[model samples]
Target: MAKSPYPVINPGGGPMGKVIIALVLIAIVTLVIKYPSDAARWVHGLGSVIDGLVDFFRTLFG
Candidate 1:
């Protein structure tokens, strides 16, 4: 038998994985829609934390 030329999407998980991913996406969408301001603030705070980490690493190694 010949191997597939196309790439496989699922890494071999069953339908449960697809269902869980779909549910998580739906929940995220719901939260964003229900709390737009909170979501924006949370994202901004996350970006700040990531930026701080980058600065810390730069000082540590550079």
Candidate 2:
């Protein structure tokens, strides 16, 4: 079998799986290029949500 670029993504997986992932990555990159501001807002929103969750868990346990 061919060596994968990132083994963690598809451990013991095949070339077909890699091709599908590459296509999905390409699509995402295209989307980000088309809508950079929207993507930035989305990523920032996700970071804030994750931060809120961490703070909540810390207050609950700490």
The CA lDDT of each predicted structure is 0.92, 0.89
Give the top-scoring candidate (lDDT). 1
Off by over 4 Å in 1: 1-12
Tens-place lDDT per residue, model 2, 1-62, is 98878747555378988888899999889889999999899999999999999999999999
Model 1 worst lDDT window (10 residues) = 4-13
| Model 2 segments more than 4 A misplaced | 1-12
| Candidate 1 lDDT by residue in tens digits, 13-42 | 799788888999999899899999998999
Measured against the true structure, the TM-scores of the candidates, in listed sequence, are 0.74, 0.69
